[model samples]
Target: MDVSMARILVLTALAFAISGWAAEEKPMLFSPVSEEPEWRLLDSGQGRFTRQEFENRLGKIFDPTGAMQPYLLFDDGGVTLFRDKARTRPLYRLTFVPEGGAGEVNPPLLGGGDPARPLAGKVICLDPGHIGGDWADIEERTFRIGNDAPVVEGELNLRTSRRLAQTLEASGAKVVWTHDGFEPTTTLRPADLYPEAISYLLQGSLGARLPKYSANRLIRWNAELLFYRSAEIQARARRVNEELRPDLTLCIHYNAAPWPGGRVRLTSANGLVVFAHGSYTAEELAFDDQKFHLLRKLLENSTPVELGVGQAIGEQFQKQWGFRPENYEGSGYSHASGAGPYVWYRNLIANRMFDGPVVFVEGPYMNDRNIYPWIQAGEYEGVRVFAGKSRGNLFREYANQVAAGVIDYFRRQAESSATFTNYSP
Candidate 1:
């Protein structure tokens, strides 16, 4: 054989060996089924923002704690992200738009219709929290006060979403649902997640890490938690990011205070809060999936939209329920959104996983002594006296305010579309 041919053969063999080594040494990811970050997915954002714009966003919304500093290297033209704090392995390089320059033109707006339909051509995805029917007990989202009827949060969320969907559709927005009924979005049951649960337990990062049961029972218990909390949400995220691809996604949930000493009971505490993603703890930033998402959300320009819709929703809550914001002041995982007292920035799993803007609404406190009676009354018609004031059923009231808030946001977006340009999105 010729020397040139021999050299080419040797180079080809070396390339294959390197490829095999890289493929076999897969990085540890958050979920057992989670695919590694597809770095190239962010290519659309190339030259979409300036360094100043990126830095302002990072300081104002994402990465407030500067946890990303360890993994990121920035230059005049772009940034390089690494998988580890030592920055030995590079993940992706993102170029910035030159200062005082315009980015590539964004795609045309989706809807141009009659003034009457402000939401025309908008796609909204509504997620009704959890599985409430047969799985409520397993999911532990149901509670009972004495002989009174059980208050199931998942069921409540579904009821609220159905109403909200109708309201949004009436305004000319196309509505999609993550799950319409009690069925879980995920097919993986607790048994299927046992191994993942074991791996999670070994990390000792999840809740219930301390021994609360026998070794076998502890692992089994965590498996159940993983199934509902992680796997189920991941499934819904797949739908949101791929199939639904909604302009905005809403995660509707009813809040409950911690049941102390494993005793489920009512409390005097009551509060309301709206969430838009932000506030990454150091621990969360350590993972590559989290690092990827933080950048994706930043470059997607979801924070502005998230905050805008969140503010409108906060107003509705004040006008309707008059509840104070749930104070997360000392909570390490949350930060004040600066939009209002009722809206805060929190990095929740659903918000992190789903692409685009997300508005997470935490409804009334089900465990509040005042709310327990309202819940017991069930999803009834018209108004009834509650806490010395006539009020609509809790579900109806929740739905109305949420629907109103969404409509308000879209109306404003429509009015401002002529002037507003989202360079990153």
Candidate 2:
């Protein structure tokens, strides 16, 4: 068989394997064999999904003959079964929710509900790129930038996602972040701090001054490490989205690529390139298109960053941040397509695993050395100025514009769907 045909067959088999598992048996529920597991309730004010309720549902779905095991009920309503002592193999996840239940609730618009009535619920999963320990692992810390240079993309992505999460939460969205820091924590660590620390230590040494070569090399090494880590982080984010079943999944990252003359350039300009899963069902695709248009309007109104700025920022960031844009074959925004590399092959995984609309945002690149201090300091206000003098009040301005756009999108969708539902020839 031809190489392409063989690859196609393998993919076909994998799909079958996944679907077969899903169809063979209902998700099983095993009682805590050891000690009674503590159940945590995720109450988002809009509604609540408790572990008990999830287990109860699972019990109903599981086949009577099936064995039970420890399982995880993710905040976004995804349930995973752990059969073996090890949690390596992920059993089937519960994808569908019965109508009119908490799981089926939609996000409410601002001021659309009475104080007494619960607001609409929406789940937003943020995947920050890179793990904290990525630099330490040489094997996992290497990745290509643009086409050649190696750089670390994970660290920058994680930091930006952390900031975005804070902004989204403050805007009344239920935000769940995957891989907080190197370890599992609520706080996000600065991506550039580790390299900066090395630089600091090197600067303190007299030998470092004699040869700038070693210092420059170290910087370049760290950047490559960041890219490898970012890839892992993106994978984890996809897993989390699968388990959580959020309303939207946003993978946040900074872009990097080589300059025309093989030199590096830094930039402060903000660009928003939204990505949707290309293999989505028609219904999901329609929803994504609506979201893409709305996001475009929101971003265009907020910053000078345009749709095709992914490559520009990617190249600029590599020169500035020492990393490269993520290399996903399916990324919609490729140079060949003039769309830029916003979409990725794994994005299909995220979309398939997730039950709702999903998007990836390659926010402003962090290579703009002029704004590095502000970003490192968590001074978003200063960062906004660095983006543009006209871009005042970073979070507030961003929140207002995005919120307005999202609200408008949903309202239109709901209205159109309602009209269609009521229509009769």
Q: Could you say which candidate leads in lDDT?
A: 1
Instruction: Flag regions of model 1 displaced more than 4 Å.
Output: 1-24, 103-115, 206-211, 260-262, 417-425
Which pairs of residues collide in model 1?
none
Model 1 has how many clashing residue pairs?
0
For residues 1-425, write the lDDT of model 2, one tens digit per residue. 24553454456457657866352243221110111111221112123333444444223222111223333334455445343335554533443343345442222222332222211365667665445354424434334335543444566556556556665565456887666666532122334434433333332321223323354444444434333433344345445645676655555554443343645554444334444433222222122222232222221121111222223333333443333344533432222213344323122333333334444455444444443433344424533454334343333333333333333343444455545555443
Best prediction by TM-score: 1
lDDT of 1 at 360: 97
Model 1, 96: alpha-carbon shift in Å? Answer: 1.4
Q: Please give the RMSD to the true structure for each candidate, in Å.
A: 9.5, 17.2
- How do the residues 239-338 of candidate 1 rate in per-residue lDDT, one tens digit apiece? 9998999988999999988886668877777899999998888787877788888888888877777887889899999998898888887787888989
Model 1 residue 238 lDDT score:
95
Q: Supply every candidate's count of residue pairs whose N, Cα or C atoms clash at under 3 angstroms.
A: 0, 23
